[model samples]
Target: MTVYRPPARKRLTQDERRAVYERCNGHCAYCGFELETMHQLHVDHVIPMEFYELYEVEGYDLDSMDNFLPACCSCNIYKHTYRLEKFRAAIERMPDVLQRDAATFRHAVRFGMVEIKQHPVVFYFEATGVDVPSLHWDAEIEKKYRTGEQK
Candidate 1:
C-alpha cells in the first residue's frame, strides 16, 4: 500500500534494521535467518500500525521503532499485518498457523512454515507502487533500512 507518512512516521534517529539485528542476535524471528550470513535482510514492523484501505499507510499511527525487526523475505510478507485475529480465522483449521517456534504477543511469524503465496503480497506492491517482489524484498528492504532508499 501507499505508505503515507505524516511527518512523524517519516523518520527515525538510528538505523532500524541494524538495531534489530543487534537486538535479536542477527536472526530473523520469523524465518530465523541469520543476517550475518544472509545476502539481504529486511526490517519489518511486527505489528502494522500503519493502517491501509487500498493504498497508503493511513489511520491511527503506531510508528515505534520497537515494532521493527530483522526478518527474512518470506516471513515479512506473511506477517504483513497486525490483525493476527483475522489471520487466525483465515488460516483456521490449519493448526500450523497457530504453531510458533517462540511466543510473540503481536507477531509470531515463522518463515518457511507455510508456502506463503505471492498474490496477496503482490497487492501491496500494486497499491504502494513498489516494484519489489517476494523474490527481491530482501535486497529492497535492506536498501530502505540502511540508506533510506525507496522506489
Candidate 2:
C-alpha cells in the first residue's frame, strides 16, 4: 500500500502561537496540563489534515486556525491524526487497552497500586466550555484543572 504524505503544515509565527497558547491559558486542550515552554507545547489539529486527503473533501480548509487546539507534547503525539471524537473515544478506552496490553498496568490495578477512574473522556477544551468548532477561547474563563490553577 502506498502511503500518502500530506503537505507541509504552515508554521505559525510567535504571535500566532501565543494566541493558540492563550486559547487554553497555556494548558493542553486535551489533558489540561500547564504547558511551561513553547517547545513543550503543540498546536494539534482538531480535525486532522489527513482527513482531507482521505475523504477528498473540497473547500474545507483543514489547515485553518479554526482547527487548532493547544496540546502538550504527549497529548499531541498520542492524538496523532485522529479526529477529536475518535481521539476522545480512544482516551475513554485507554484503561481497557492498558489492562489488556500492559502487564505492569494490569498488575498495578490488580494489586490496588493504581486506581482507575471510570468516566467519559472530556477534553479540557470541552470542560472549559470553549467553542471548539469556532476555535474560540475565552481567556476570561477560569479553569479548575486537576493540576490546580495557574499561578
What local distance difference test score does each model get?
0.47, 0.78
In angstroms, the error of model 1 at 76 is 0.7
Q: Which ten residues in a row have the lowest lDDT in candidate 1?
A: 52-61
Taking the tens digit of each residue's C-alpha lDDT, what string does model 2 give over 1-151?
Answer: 9988777898989888888888898889999999998777798888787765632333345676777889999899999988677888999999989989999999999899999998998889889977665332212122323446653
For candidate 1, the TM-score is 0.41
- Tens-place lDDT per residue, model 1, 1-151, is 8856434444544465466555556666544566674345666654464442212322223454534556667667766774434533444433444443324511424444444342322222233343222324334445666996554
- Candidate 1 lDDT score at position 22: 58
TM-score of each: 0.41, 0.78
Error of 2 at 141 (Å): 30
Candidate 1: lDDT over CA atoms? 0.47
Model 2 lDDT, residue 95, Cα: 91
